[model samples]
Target: MNKSSVTVQPLRNTQTKIAIIGGGVAGSTIALRFAELGLDTTLIEKGPSLVNGPPICHLHAGGNLYREISDEQCLTLLQQSIETVKVYPQSVNVRPTVIALPKTDHGQPEDLLPRLEKLRKRYSELVSADISNKVLGEPEDYFRFYSRAEVDALVNKSIPSKATQASDWLISFANFTDLNKLKFPVLLVQEYGLSAFRFAAIASLAIERLPSCHLQTHSQVTAITADEDNLGWQVSTKLQGNDNIQQQQFDYVINACGFKSGEIDDMVSAKRQRMVEFKAAYVAHWPQCQGLWPEIVFYGERGTPQGMAQLTPYPDGYFQLHGMTQDITLFDQGLVASSLQSAQPKLAQRFIEKIDKKWPEQLIHNRTLGSIEHMAQFIPQFSSAIVAAKPLFGAQQIPGDDPELRAADVSFHGKHYARAEIVKASSALAAADAILANLSECGLITDPAIEGYLTEHYFPVSQQCSDIEVTERAILLAKQRDYPDALAKNL
Candidate 1:
């Protein structure tokens, strides 16, 4: 039996059913896709709204997606994301981002020109020559590098450092007055600030109002099992504050739950997965300091606990700072997991001090976002980030080279699809596209009309989808380096 010609199951009825578990960006997109296709779709989320708290990185926007994937891929993801939030355009805002490369003994600051030249070259291909914006510039203009003078000028023009003694644009050490902290600054883009919050609210609104879609909140999925009779899946969900469980059977199920995906997979499969935890902090500036800067990334000296601190200013007038994480090669699953809350305050204070020591005025009068658990970053192995599925058969792990099956992780196991670590919402667009393409490849839906629509509207992927294996920074690899009280590791 040649696998290429393998005959699987197809939709017996014209009305195909799909259940999108988790209402974050990806799940929401999947729901929208099925709805647009006129399929019977249901969106299940434990949270009251799509923009639920904590687990995922709801703030970074798609710029980080740029850092992980190719420029073209990133652009497509963002475009899809923009389209998803189209119902509430105000919910999506794309702004310029700046990454400050603080002076270090290692690299030449002058080298930034060539490196940025290349990055911008890649960005150039994405620009629409005719559709340029005065504020956004050409699409390529969105990606640029500003020297010290340029940075200082922009800072002064936008949000001047109120200090009696002025400093460079980049946030730095306590000795900000020390001119030595300056280096090259690079800009990117993101779905950040208030845009991230709006992305969630509007996505929920757009999905809920769809006539073919049923948006169910306060509902938690407890179990997902294979339906032997329907050759589909039975999803069991329980509403919050209630013990009784309700179930629904669907032809397909998509798991875009971020950190909790493996939990849902466990309901039907025996496999379990691991997650990498990253600690972060969210600080809101006083409403008065309206320094609406785009996503700002600051790189610290090697071995310092501040190896990486990305500063994001919200449309609501707050700042979010995400710091580094501790490396755990040895699994201490044996040790009782420390209370994540007890460690959050320590992480928050550490980030607060990092910001204060560098830019005191911002946090001069501010508040913490919410729980510390919100600060922890838990990512499952990248290998399983996105998996295409069949109801009981599982992911179609086709061997050798096959571009069609290779597009995204089109894993299929009993009509169950899952994408892990969907931290950035933009990735959701690609996930939905992948599922549609893979579903067709699995011989599940052979309608030429639906296929034609998908082909005409597919998210172009120049390269196969794979987990980003590169750790953004290696300076934090120093094992024994001591972190200050504020930057110390939480329990």
Candidate 2:
């Protein structure tokens, strides 16, 4: 990626300014881009900091994008997010997640290598670099299929009979039984894990660190009205800490306030109802133990695939295990805390029992939600459990629904702008592009003399928040060769 050689003048109408509501990944990245372009940007977050804590707020990124979107889009956005997150004040652990696939028929362990090799042949550009004995793949290189032996080596533990019985490391079905097989490939993927506080901390830092940007934390937006006088909108903000009220104007406004987007848009648009579904999960921490746990996403061994269980480990020896409930959700920020605490341990505990029985019980020291939990009886480190709510997929909404997100890869332009589908962190990358397009379209950021300057130099990598593994793994497959350019494919 190239950096611009020329200086940029302030992009927006100097007096009106640009008010960005929300400080999550979507809003923060948008703020980062406008600021870099030399725009006078004001970012407002209702919370004390960008990422407020867990009455809600513990979040995860990676794999979801890699698996759901195209390889080009996934890799590019992931790279950008990785870079931006490096500056997060807290620790961001880089870990490769392993997804298990269960076998239905008896297949040799040798069969796993061929499958990955075939993927390698098909997507030569996606392969990771090798490290002497093991074949590496993307995140940095090609995602690989690890054998059971390799899995054992990764965990530094001997293969248990339950593990050894499976020819491979995958468990495809949602539910496993004595009949289901385990002799297939386990997907080894590169992913990142960090506290939402850390994620938000870095994002807030990016907004404030930019010379042209002003970050207003704990600033609640009370109203937005048309200011045809200035050909923009008048914004009313109540400074929570000072109890002071201030009115400002912006040439353009972007609503990236997550679930509350519609609630905020009510000042100008129609009213829309918001909803969120509940999900149960458990977490625990072990003392005096070195955590080498690989994040594992399990499918199932039962009939058709059941939902998966995602296990993430932190630097603080706090290991979180959740999943089982899948699909999207819509949440109300105010209810997140009480709801999670009120959740029963049924789902999370059932997931633990359904997956494995070998976990040693009695390692319980702290339980986050309840006194007696089923997971504690099997896993020594099993602590407390709770349920969480998330914004449902395709849930971002505004009253008028002017700037739509039918397809979220880009932005839609209207009186007020928004990246409507950016409910997750990864969506921020592409949504940033959409926001820039809107800014440029609204004439708030006009720099035609160096027209392609920003897009050419920074767009490719702006979304990254942390350092990334840099390598140009070339495309080698026949089908892949036909496309010729790997950059053309994006989701």
Candidate 3:
């Protein structure tokens, strides 16, 4: 008997539906992509707005902060950072980063030369491939070196009203930093800063304008199950204040819940190994400090008394600080992992309270002060800085329990489910592209227009919002979220 050939029908753009849980940067990026493609998509977020999770101040274009990561990881970060900046151009703080090593540090300044050269070459290649990819100025001017004598000379020079050259951005740091403590020939890389608030505003505005994408905020997912018909999955969610449950069905489900992505994994009985970490950055105001400063990184050992200290400058004399010591940015038992019983890693109730509610004033004071003193060792004037507002803190998920891991994208469980475990916000778009490719391979996306659009597209809706509009909305968002409005504005 000849077996009848099974007729498999490809789904149309309207027939294929996607449900993205968790409205953090990852979920928001995915929703934006699907929306631009004119596909049926639903984005469910438990928070009041999108991108309301962890602190995102640095755009690691070259992955220079973490010296332990591989060069491959650095290249990936460079590509993703460029794409992110293109998507949210208004959010980028166009300033160079000063990477300095104190006398107490073990690493040598010469050790970074190889990686810097590699990054410069790769950047040149990207620019050559496409002229518009030259976002970080010139590829030849990607990084610069300054000797101790050069820095000392700049201490007396006046700060540039608008920093055009690499040396122009180094005046403030050279004036404040203790020259005796740092190694010679410090590095100034093209790595810039990212405004989390501005990124959030742009993402929210772009998603709102898309009619095909439905955004549900202050909504929590309760349960999920495979439908009896075997065509899709059913998701149950409850509003923040209501107990009544509402259910929705989708052909494909994406778990992009950020640090709580493991919870979604557990709901579907999908066992996975992961870890969650809680970290914070404090805000301080130095009214007496003059001139614009670049983002400063004083490298040190992590989890020790002298961990890495980062100083991120904002407008209006406000600066964001992070000290990796236990008393400052890191807390006791702040990092936890999934156990044999469940895939969800348990964070302490206190940390969870900080994320869900407000941080106690005492805790904020002590931590902010600690971070100030930590930076004062290198920049004595920083000791006079006062706490500006509440610290930006949240729990971030790390896949496979390696806390030092910096590069990650997306993972697939089955044919119908995709989980995004992106370690950095810059990796969000790449993760979205992976999910889109997965849907195409599964025969779920059959639209010719969508296919042609995906072939050579980096960003489809880059010009959706004007700079003035993004700034106005981002400042409002920062104030509403209990942060200093300066945090939303670039320096």
Candidate 4:
């Protein structure tokens, strides 16, 4: 296929044209929202598909994983997660999460109560405001405490065939975990799992049906410059395996390129302060471990010998694992910041190689086995779990230097440009809404149709797919990406 420069001439009195850079969660969400509003939109993705950046298995509903973050951030996360679920209900894996503190940790379970209580109360209020906001289950069941004796009682019992209630999800955990190694009164919260691949499937399929939205995969944005009239932007893109460039003009440009947003910022001479961190999650197939399981979190100090360990379960006994230690999920110099001269942060080339090319088999084996060993400290049976496939990993961008920052939306540069710097996957929709609000303020959108869409009962344009269709497409996407088909389906 020969590539040639094709310019999109600015139309007179036409619908607002939007060019969204990157096809990750944030960009895809913004494009979908714009297309739903009947705006002429183009989604440019460097990869073959969408949402293929960092692996986001766990939805940080209530921000339970990060105890250091403020309660306000936790509440924001709760609200964002609710909105995300409403928009992509088919992408959610309906399961709870177990949060426990090991004996080696300094903090107690009581340290978590205040936040949990606040989350529960907020959840109750949201449900009261709109009954459908009860996506995390009944507010009363937002979180439940399990005393040591109660958990100990199930230590000798068999794992339930299927987990119906929150406690039922703990049978295997209680039986397999070394009870003495953990603190008392473990809490099970209503946080759930999100399949990135499934989300990509939904967004791509939905965009394909929208007449106003153009989906361009394998098209990388090479250069961006303001038009001579100063009314719009001229975006130059290069197709994969092609030397020629194609330039297009749009009324507005959104930088949503995940960790590479700063590159675009530099292209437009927009000053920014950002950090990028590379992280990975291992896939382990433990077929012998029968029965359904809730996602488990063992909190410890980050970047230490005893760091946070996460076990996320998928269908068919395939478990996704994350260890916050440097030897496992994190790496030395994995987190880097932008320099004074350039807006983009420089990660080590080895990480860039892994991101752009394939990971060496030896390195995959070492890190994955290391992740398995990290989990085996609490659950001994997990030691028998072998590496299932290549890890799900990518570099994520933190808008500011604060690594602990969890809740963020979109930031605007000028009247016609916006940058989405969401820290969590749940925050994608909120960022898109912020962009829409900015567009309205800039007079690009005179009349907004989906105001307060999150709280209302109306369906999103992307909700055209039935549950079964979403499942089938998601599973096919997983297989195409070289992941196990089970990862796309819920347990």
> After superposition, which runs of candidate 1 have C-alpha atoms over 4 Å from their true positions?
1-13, 53-89, 105-119, 127-136, 152-179, 185-194, 270-278, 287-292, 301-304, 315-317, 325-410, 414-421, 455-491
lDDT of 4 by residue, 1-491 (tens): 01112122222243788999999999988888777656789999999988998989978889999998989999999999998898888889988999999999999999899889999999999999989788999999999999998898777677887766667888988988888899989999999999997898888778777666798999989999998877799999999999899999899999999899989999999989999999999999888888868899999999998999999999888999999999999999999999888889999999999999999999999999999999999999889999899999999999888888889978889669999998899999888888877776678776544345422423355786677777888888888889999898867
lDDT tens readout by residue for model 3, 180-249: 9989899999999998998888887777676667999999999989887655899999999999999998
Question: What are the lDDT figures for the candidates, one per model?
Answer: 0.43, 0.44, 0.87, 0.87
Write model 1 residue lDDT over 1-491, tens digit each, in one string.
12223222232335667788887656776776666555578989887666442323233323342233354444444444443333323443434455555465244445444434553444354343323212233445444455556545443344433322222323322112223454644444333333333344445444544566788999999888887764688899999999999989887778766445555656666243333222224443334334333455554432243344444444334444444322110111211111223211122343334322332433322212221121211111111211111000001111112211111322344444544334345455556767877666655566766567564432211111111111111112111121111111110
Better of 2 and 4 by TM-score: 4
What is the descending lDDT order?
A: 3, 4, 2, 1
| Models ranked on TM-score | 3, 4, 1, 2
The 10-residue segment with the lowest total lDDT in model 4: 1-10
For candidate 2, write residues 26-66 as lDDT tens digits: 67767776676677788888865553312122223332312
lDDT score for residue 173 of model 4: 88
Any residue pairs clashing in model 3, and if so which?
none
Better of 1 and 4 by lDDT: 4
TM-score of each: 0.62, 0.60, 0.96, 0.95
lDDT comparing candidate 3 with the true structure: 0.87
Candidate 2: misplaced stretches above 4 Å?
A: 1-16, 53-92, 101-141, 149-183, 241-244, 270-283, 288-291, 300-306, 326-413, 456-491
